[model samples]
Target: MFKKLKDGVNSLKKKVEEKTGIKEEEIRPEEIPETQETDEKPIDKDSDVKDKKTSFKNKAKKFIKERKVILSEDDVEDPISDFKFDLIENDVAFDVAEKIGEDVKKDLVGQEIKWREDVGKIVNESLRNSILNIFTSEFEFNRYIKETDKPVVIIFVGTNGVGKTTTIAKMAKMLRDKDYKTVLANGDTFRAGAMEQIEKHGEKLDLKVIKHQEGSDPAAVIYDAVEFAQANNYDIVLGDTAGRMHTDVNLMDQIKKIKRVVDPNLVFFVDEAVAGSDAVERAREFDEAVDIDASILTKIDADVSGGAAISISYATKNPIIFVGTGQSYDDLRKFDPEWFVEEIVG
Candidate 1:
């Protein structure tokens, strides 16, 4: 999915080596010998010769300890620029790309590189740490759900066609599989067939669905679901709201109303991984409007660039808790930052 970013990193490695004449492999301390053999004297029993050898060993040790490879500003300038362009071309937000470039420069410029160290590996590690820094909140989704109190209310929000409804169903199935009594609330009464779609999933999963007629107030449906969960002892309530673009002020306001009425424990913003930077912008806007607790990216398996997955959490300052991998009830997978970095950089 991150083919472009990976290629760009490889290019950066080559450029660094080309510009600095530095080999990719690092030199180890043990590789340096303590002394060199001399043809002048083979004094096997001479104490003076032994003392000379010891002195030579100490000098060599000191030299090796003091030696370090440092990259100058000019050494990294061109490579960082090229890599920044590469990130932007791959749909990374300009600000994010710039931040990565600056971070790489900070880590590499004037930093010591072992003589036999893999320069590429060092750069890659720096990039990985920089990217990981962008993730502010991370948690195990299943554990969080299980640990929360009974009838935990989770509201799903996103733009149209990001697979919000289907993702909700997948989440419901996930909870149900864990033996949590779940109920689906179709708060998306403004959208045609939204109720029917969620109801169909409910039937398939043998889970109950709470809904109201189309055009009815969305908040009322959620309120009913919450009350029902309280009364009937359901373990979780997965509420689905109507999909709307960030530009739709009215629909955004409706989401705000739902948030007010439901007081959900968690609010997830659903998006498509293929949406790239657009998804990041939408996440920002939605978060501004409703303060989303986390994100759920859909169609990740189909996204080639993987920019959205990389940038959304960073841009919105929210963690991505789950990802929709395919078109199945069990396709939703928990997000792992380390696994994602490995997939992109390994």
Candidate 2:
């Protein structure tokens, strides 16, 4: 996982080391004093003082030059520029890549380093810090659910073919494992078989699903589900909305209506991680419309670059609640940014 991103960062570090010439180890003076000399030629008393002074000066200059190497902005400019291109090629959003490059450049410039290994270590750590800063919010979904009020309503929204529906089913299974009394609500009335898809999951999970006929009011469907949960003491309600792109004004309006009616405790924006920057843009649009509480990314196990996860969290300033790693109902895992950083940076 994240193999491509790791390789790109490692390559950038190597370039920085090469461009700055920090890999060379300087020879030390071996504690030689002005009076010490190994030369076989006899030292002439008249010129001995002058010769020793000149040798000491040369040693002092070499020691200072080697020990106090400082990297300048111009030294790292080309390497950082190349890193930005690598990021964009690996599906990082152009704006995000630019921001990350500038941050790394700032962190590296004018930094003092000892000769030998410090240069590479500084560059690598700086890149790691830059990426870690992108994951601003650290969230744990199960912890939040355990503390929040019962009968919590969570609406899931995303564009088409992004696995929004399956994600809801996985979430239902996850809640069941936690021993929460959960119910599924099918608000995706526009899709021809959307109702059936969620219904099938309900049957498999042995949970009740509230639904209205296709083309019926979706908001009412979720509202009814919430009411049922309240009456039955269900712990949570996971609502599925019709998948629609940001460009689809009508569907976007309908989604907004669902949020308004349900007043869900949380709104989760689901997207496939493979979509990369496309997913980042979509996440921003969805959050703006409905004010999403968190984000859920699917197909993470198959993602190569892993830029979408970083970009989405940075773009929305919202925590990444979960990521779908596999096809099984139990494959959903809480998103941990620290673990992600370790995998991508180490």
Candidate 3:
């Protein structure tokens, strides 16, 4: 997935190795046998400790508590700066890249590298931590669903062609498996086939879709859906709104009015992972317009740079509840920060 990031980290490791022939211990454990005396004497008590650093081949190598090589900021400053540029070139937002760089630099500068530990391990591990820190939230949608009040209302908002409708359908399937009685609400009345698109998904999933005729009030549609959920004891209501650009003031105001009318428990900002920084900016704007509860990023499997996935949560200050990995209903997975980092670095 993050082939670019992986390669960049690898390149940085090699550069650090080449730039500063910093120091490897000449006294390896294998050279010192258990009972046999070797010509290589132990570090002289009278000699300068800085003159000799020891490395060992023993499986339990952490016994030595001494810091052999201390990394200076100058040693990694240029290499880490180049890596930050690589992150930006890969579609990661500039602010996010800066944060990652600063975190990595702060972590690596003056750090201790133990004996038998190569610079590559220390460098890559630091990079991994810096990248993972950008994903600040560990929000779980399943917990929210299980604990939140029944008939919970979630309104999905985003620009057109970002898979908002399909994502709603996917979420409905997920809720149904959990034995939650769910209903689909078509709040999008602007587009010509908007009603049919959601209806088709509703029919396939065997869920009821509530809607109004074309050019009707969107807020009214979702209001009616909420009413229906209350009467029928539905566990949740998934409402789909007409996709519109952030520049469209009227449409943005329409969403605001719907939020006011329904007072949805959650507002989901849906967009594609492939949209990169553009998706992050859109999520920010949407969050400003209507406070977002979480985000759902589609086409994650197709995204190579991982910019949207890395930047959206940090930008919006809202958790990414789910990521659409593929086209199937089963492809939706809860966002896990640890797992995502592993996928990239492991």
Residue 171 displacement (Å), model 2: 1.5
TM-score, prediction 2 = 0.86
Model 3 clash pairs?
A: 151-235
Best by TM-score: 2
lDDT (C-alpha) at residue 86 in model 2: 87
List TM-score per model, in order.
Answer: 0.85, 0.86, 0.85
**Over the stretch 213-246, how does candidate 2's per-residue lDDT look in tens digits?**
9999999999999999999999999999988998
In candidate 2, clashing pairs total: 0
- The whole-model lDDT of each prediction reads 0.84, 0.85, 0.82
> What's model 2's lDDT at 154?
94
Clash count, one per candidate: 6, 0, 1
Model 1 has an lDDT value of 0.84
TM-score of 1: 0.85
